[model samples]
Target chain A: MCQLLGMNANKPASLHFSLAGFMCRGGRTGEHSDGWGAAYFEGHACHLLVESRPSANSPLARWLHEQPLRSRNIIAHVRKATRGAVALENCHPFVRELWGRQWAFAHNGHLKDFDLPLRGRFTPVGSTDSEHAFCYLLEALFRRFGHTPPPTPALFEALAGLACEISGFGSFNFLLSNGDGLFAHCSTQLHTLQRRYPFARARRIDDGVTIDLGRHNHLDDRMVLAATAPLTEDEDWTALRPGELKYFRGGQDLPDGVPVAAPLLLAV
Target chain B: MCQLLGMNANKPASLHFSLAGFMCRGGRTGEHSDGWGAAYFEGHACHLLVESRPSANSPLARWLHEQPLRSRNIIAHVRKATRGAVALENCHPFVRELWGRQWAFAHNGHLKDFDLPLRGRFTPVGSTDSEHAFCYLLEALFRRFGHTPPPTPALFEALAGLACEISGFGSFNFLLSNGDGLFAHCSTQLHTLQRRYPFARARRIDDGVTIDLGRHNHLDDRMVLAATAPLTEDEDWTALRPGELKYFRGGQDLPDGVPVAAPLLLAV
Candidate 1:
């Protein structure tokens, strides 16, 4: 198993604080040392950084320590190489273009026998079940909606249905973003926390470091963070229910009231 | 106009030597201060680093100077923002996946009214004539030859014919790679140089620094470099012909004997 981290903020926010603790899990605090990757959405573009080396010891990771890439949405993952070779192509988050926007996806858990029909519209560059599932998900969406998406709620409903069908295969915790906001699904382990006007001091779960969020955040700086495991110990982190889909935009949760489509028998 | 630099090597080689000088053109040596980007191919994966800020002054560029990401094929570009906005989306080399392989592309010149209708399979994330042209090129090829490409020579022929058509719109000098090798099409300004067994001392044209390449490379190490301008003053850089398409693999040319298909009236 791997790990996933996501951030959605009303105002563009820096992720160094959370990323510091999160990267430690790549090698220092945990054994997920196969690789590490991240994607930060800035305007219509997603800047992706993926390394096959362990993040805790990578030079790029060190530079990221100093430079704060402010963004409204971000997704990150540390890999343990459950279903693919330990290579850069297998590193998440994987970026693809759909509807003229760069979409990035990252998976934390395995999907057994996820051999989906690609149909040539989308294909996996890496030999990972996660990438294969991702491509399949995109192909399904494109087939249904063509280029532009349907109304927001309709699209959400379709994604939830797709998630439900895939989760049946195995643990399916994943994070996705298309420069607008973040979409996350949990089949096994996931946690989420909100940071807002009333901030609190937090302790890093990995390194035991502490910081006062109140000093670093503005009054309007509302944000949501979701991860496979909570990065901080002091903050209140909510455990996402199994087989749940979550949507976040501009720091607030978009309630998952959209009903999943009739159980999909669509399997490869 | 922008600037392009590409490397195809027999052995996986470090790019610091060429990149150190190439990056200077983003602000120091030349005036391409709009943006800059680079792509390094590792096996079937391409690690891309792009920034909206000038490469000569970007924090990421400074960090890259200290680390060596060696690869067999590489492409870099420094933009002067002739058409699109100065943003991350407009930064090249732009990457898209086809046939489950990541293809990276970058251009050095502008095209007037280079609007091409996209058929939805591929689209540009940015509003640049360069990217639009790129998407059109890919669409044409995919339309003719689905996901899997024809033979190598046949693919090269199609690409050369496409290049001839697009170059009619502007000075379309570009470098494209799909991890295996590099394809270069030069309309106005481009140069090529080969570094092999009898390497000699070289001085950087941008930074005025000198290095003895003979000492740094192995006896069998071979590389071919293509750029919009000669990076070093001492090297024997050959200026590409007014209209030329060159293919390079493992540091050697594949000899352009492939015949171009007759021009078609497929204007978008």
Candidate 2:
């Protein structure tokens, strides 16, 4: 098992506050201590930092917590290494380039016997079911859309369908982002929180640190956060139902693009 | 023009000492103050850090100089923004995945009116002639070798030929690596230094910092370093001829895979 965290903001924002609490799950509060990774997207480029060490005490992670690397989209993961060796390459949030955009993906749950054929186009650099699944998703998208990117709605639909199909193997809870949007899919467990103009006080669940969210945010700033578990105790975190997919862009949730009434099946 | 630095080692070595001097060129010693990047390969995974700020004064770069991130292969660049805006995406070294390995490339010189048609396989996320040339090289390699990577000799030959073709547009000095090997191409300026058993005192050219290399290294430790200019004051650095390509693996130079007598011409 692993813990995943994602953030989408209307303006370039730092994940330092949330990351401080979330990273506690890597060793202090939780058992996901094998490895950890974080990806911060600045336009089309990303700063991807990963280490095969517990983030709770890693000097690099500590340095990262102090630095305010602002980004519109961010994804992070702390791994427990259920599927692959505890190596640097197996650390999540894995990244790939698709349609001239740098895409990042991170998984929170394990997939059982998830062996899918890759079309030799977006192959995995690491031996992890999560990476294999990410490659499959990219390959499927490339095969369907060719060189040009489809509209956002169409992409959301295709991704929802793919997520549903992949969930059939096992738990496939994941968060994916390509700088423009952040997509989160729930297989068993996932939570979301929204922060806007009327922000209030929040308290960290891992440590008893209190912070006035209003002091750090501007009036126009809007943001959405997704995590496997709630990082703050005071915030109202919404739990997504199983097999649900949510899309967020510019810190606001887009209308439910996937039909929620029926189960999605990727048409081959 | 930008500045390039690369290292290939027989062991997982830290580039902190050399990087300390090399990053000084970002603003302290030279005028490559647009941006800077560094890529360190840990097996198939790469820690790619890029900032659209001068490395000499950047806090992140300062932290990096203090940390000992060990790797067998490393590439770093200080950008001057010859053909692209000073953005994070435009910073080197650029990275892409192919054949289950992460390949990193950094270019030092500018390409004049270099617009080549991409085959829609590997696309450039950033708008730079350097990235465009990198994508062209990858696409050409994929077209020639398909999914499976060719032998080292074949790959060296293919890359040498591609380097020659790309250099026709302008100066294209570059350093490329896929963890297993480091390939350097010289259009007008490139220098290499070999350090092995009999290490001696070395002084930085940018700063007058002197260090006894033998005190920090073991007898079996071997490394090959590539830079646009000699980083140290008292090292015997070899200058590669124009249109010449050099391949290195395990910190040692391989035989001239391409015939030195005749210039390479990539067949369409």
Candidate 3:
């Protein structure tokens, strides 16, 4: 189907090992060879790259593997087209702006009867359900709070509620962020791992590569990793329970009992 | 938050216009600025690139905007860390393999307690729940049908079921593929658009730029684009329902009631 990879850490880190292995699915080891994309966040700025070539064996993919790109937060994807024809416009890892803050998103499932609603202010450039969702979410946010972002707890509660509501219609596993925190929700199959002190050696299942976090990462740094499935052989990954959503900041989950914001309707 | 952009067409297409606008979110217009990445799919492979720099002004991002990279399918992402420590190891759009096919995925949400019981067969190289979920899906597919991929209908049904099972945890919106077709699921936010005859000049919502797709695409070629939000200023984007999933092949949805090999796992 598709694969997703995300990392949250207390310090700058590189996804070279994970990306190297993930690239194999672009063309070498598998056939999601539609296109690939990735994003890395550095404070209020980000670096983005996109291509319509397989990542496993593509020159670009190879170069990236050796480039050792680093960031405190990152999101990457390889695509297998579901809607949109196999064209550059239909790739994954879409980015947008809401309340002057940058937001990123990637998806792994499909939706039914997804029609673009003519939401005021926010509109879509491409023709995909993923974009519609993003627009809708932001439109709702803007509708509820105008230009100011709500408190983290309030925002989280609202987002979680909206996510849960959206999940009822179809599969809605996704990863979202706003430079302040990373939010993840699993509808069907998603997993996560937190790496703290005592990092260990990990072997990639797709490419059979191994790396020790202790050697690669600073010991004091804490990290959280989430994906559709496990990619390493040595570490333990926890699967998300049905209808569960979590927020991470500095690699730690936020406490519960956050006040929820009022729901905003999609702009039409 | 995170963003994804994708294009699928019968022939290769470039994402210059869309990407140009998306890059602004890295730092110029928005803030998904943890990192940036993109990939292209050609035949049975993908070409990938990632940079841990601000895409809005990154030399590489600007180069890509001017350099036309063409492909039949594409994927890209911009990230803001909420989980794993800020590092390259925690990137989105993780790729993997199963049944001798490459698979790619990106996410825009977070999963809680996503650490699932992962066997040594499939593991995560990064520390994102998104990758873990991807591996689990592949592992289940491999386990269900062994090495040889099942028929398309059978495979779709199985994967769809798996998607539903995982969605129970949280939001499970995603896009998946194996060179044959694309599978997408919506848990919260997802959008899709199809462009056929009567192409028009579309403007980027993020960058205030415009492009005439009719000049770049052929009358005979149709395309579908998916994203986290609409990139263009004027376009219709369908929003995915909470629990909806679908597949697209050559810019068309799969016929309904096509003997799905597995039963829809409602319980999951």
C-alpha lDDT values of all predictions:
0.90, 0.91, 0.70
User: Against the true structure, what is model 3's DockQ?
Assistant: 0.03
lDDT of 2 by residue, A1-268 (tens): 9999999998999888889998999999988899999999988878899999999988889989888778899999999988889998899989888888899999988788888789889889999999999999999999999999988889988998999999999999999998888999999999999999899799999998899999999999999999999999999899999999999888888866432343678899
Query: DockQ of candidates 1 onward, in order?
Result: 0.67, 0.69, 0.03
CA RMSD of all predictions? 7.7, 6.6, 19.4
TM-score of chain A of 2: 0.95
Compared with the true structure, what per-residue lDDT tens digits does model 3 show for residues B172-259? Answer: 6777765555676777877877777788789888867788888877888777777777788677778877777767666556643153
User: On a 0 to 1 TM-score scale, where does candidate 3 land against the true structure?
Assistant: 0.52
Off by over 4 Å in 3: A116-118, A257-268, B1-268
Instruction: Return the lDDT, model 1, position A177.
Output: 92
CA displacement after TM-score superposition, residue A172 of candidate 2 (Å): 0.5
lDDT score for residue B114 of model 2? 90
Error of 1 at A213 (Å): 0.5
Docking category for candidate 1? Answer: medium
> What's the true lDDT of residue A12 in model 2?
97
Which of the numbered candidates is closest to the native, going by highest DockQ? 2
lDDT score of residue A230 within candidate 2: 93
